[model samples]
Target: MTTSTTTPLQRWKTFFADRSSVVSGIITLVVVVLTLISYTGFLQAVERRSGVVFVDSIHRILGPIDVTWPTFVVLYASLILALGVLLTRPEHLFRTLRAYSILVGIRVICMALLPLDPPMTTIPLHDPFVALFTSSEHSTLTKDLFFSGHTATLALLALSMPTRSLRIVFILSTTALATFTVLQHVHYTVDVIVAPMAALLAFVLNRGFAAENQ
Candidate 1:
């Protein structure tokens, strides 16, 4: 009998080369892209969406900061950095993608199930992606407020990343985003609070499925 030990890179290459892994990656990408399109389409019609005006007391006390641009930059920058960390270890790629796909699916369902009017005092979140679909640069999306997608995404990154250090960074990043969203009156307090629980559930479920695949 002959036994061969595969290097980490070799293992990752083999996994990526596998039909199932490739399919998973492709599916994840498709889900992400489609989810974005669907979510944005929903947002574009927020003007007609049925939602009651919500008065967020948290935004009342904190008083929104005029840091929408800075917060947006930080959120996207942290996500990019987290991806860089994961890319350094190719072994983590597929599992992370699988978890992310589930996160997107959950978010889509949540958005459909819950309709929300943005807090009246919203600071006008300046997200470029959201801006692309809006007629005006400062158009505040008063709907699609079931949960905090930004917070959930960071929570997903924190849960899916392989290293403890990466996890901590992502967690702090998630916390920052949660705070920023509330301070900016971009999301209701409950939306930010409940996002991580949903992300964690998706992460756990995806982990079990990946283990079964192995």
Candidate 2:
């Protein structure tokens, strides 16, 4: 009998060939898509309501700047890089997706419980990609504050990386993204500060869930 060599392509094919793996991937993707769509609707509704604005000592010190381009640059580039790495490891990709979906659900709950208006010195963030899905009037959202979604997303990506080098790179990228969000005043200091903690909670929960299934 001749032995067969396992290549990267063969491994990927084998992964997809497993019915359980395929089902899990489909479920995760559906959950993520639904979570995102729900978040968009919630954001638009929250934008219509008014909330209290408070003073943040940190925001007072740094003030607001228009760092929109730089913010998206780091955010999207890091996401692309993380996806490139995670795709090679299909399991990691699924883990990241589940964690991210959990993160968004957490954010929605927190935002619902604590409605917040943007900072008094807020420089509105303009995301071109998000604009595509929203109406012109609802394009710039300011009330989805509690925790920073941008920061949490990058933090989740960092935690989900399968390698030390990738983790380090994502950690730095997350830090930069957090700084950019705060500098832009698109999020309050507390928002960015709590983001990593929220992300960690999601990551830990996802890991536990996966472990139980295993």
Candidate 3:
């Protein structure tokens, strides 16, 4: 009798061949896409409405500095790195997607409940890539506050990383992004401060749901 062993390629093939995995991935993608669409529309409406603007001591200290390009560089670079690592494990990618979708959904709800106006010293963060996809009228949004999406995104990535070293790297990246967002006055101190906690909550909830299903 001859024994056969599965190669890495075969394992990947098996993972893709699984009907459940494929269906789960498709559903996750659809949910994420729909959530993002709703988020964008909600933000546009929020921008049109007037809201309260409170004085933040941290923003007063840091003032407003335009670090838009550097902010996007760090944000997108960390995102690309996280995707590269997560793509190696399809299950991890799915979990991350589910967690992120939940995070964005939470943000949408929070922003709706807490209508915040942009900081007095606000410097608009102009993202070139966002500009490419969005019209000029809606590209530069300033009122999507109460929680910083940039900070939370990096924090979630840090939490989702499988290895300690990567986690540390992403944690530091999260801190840097938080600082950049504050320095640019794109978000308030409270927004950045609350972001990591929100991400942690989302990650924990997603893991708990996964455990229950298992």
Task: Identify the candidate with maximal lDDT.
Answer: 2
Q: Tens-digit lDDT track for model 2 on 84-200? A: 887777777888999999999999999999989999899999888777756689897778899998899899998988778989999999999899888889988999999999999
Q: Alpha carbon lDDT of residue 37, candidate 1?
A: 78
Which model, 1 or 2, shows the larger lDDT?
Answer: 2
Candidate 1 C-alpha lDDT tens digits along 69-129: 7677778888789777666555476667777778767876887777677887776675776
Clashing pairs in 3: none
Ranking of predictions according to lDDT: 2, 3, 1
TM-score of the candidate numbered 2?
0.93
Model 2, position 199: C-alpha lDDT score:
99
Clash list (residue pairs), candidate 2: none
Q: What is the Cα root-mean-square deviation between model 2 and the actual structure?
A: 3.0
lDDT (Cα, 0-100) at 50 in candidate 1: 73
The C-alpha TM-scores of every prediction are 0.83, 0.93, 0.91
**Candidate 3, position 210, lDDT:** 82
In order, candidate lDDTs are 0.75, 0.87, 0.86
The RMSD of every model to the true structure, in order and in angstroms, is 3.8, 3.0, 3.6
* Best model number under TM-score: 2
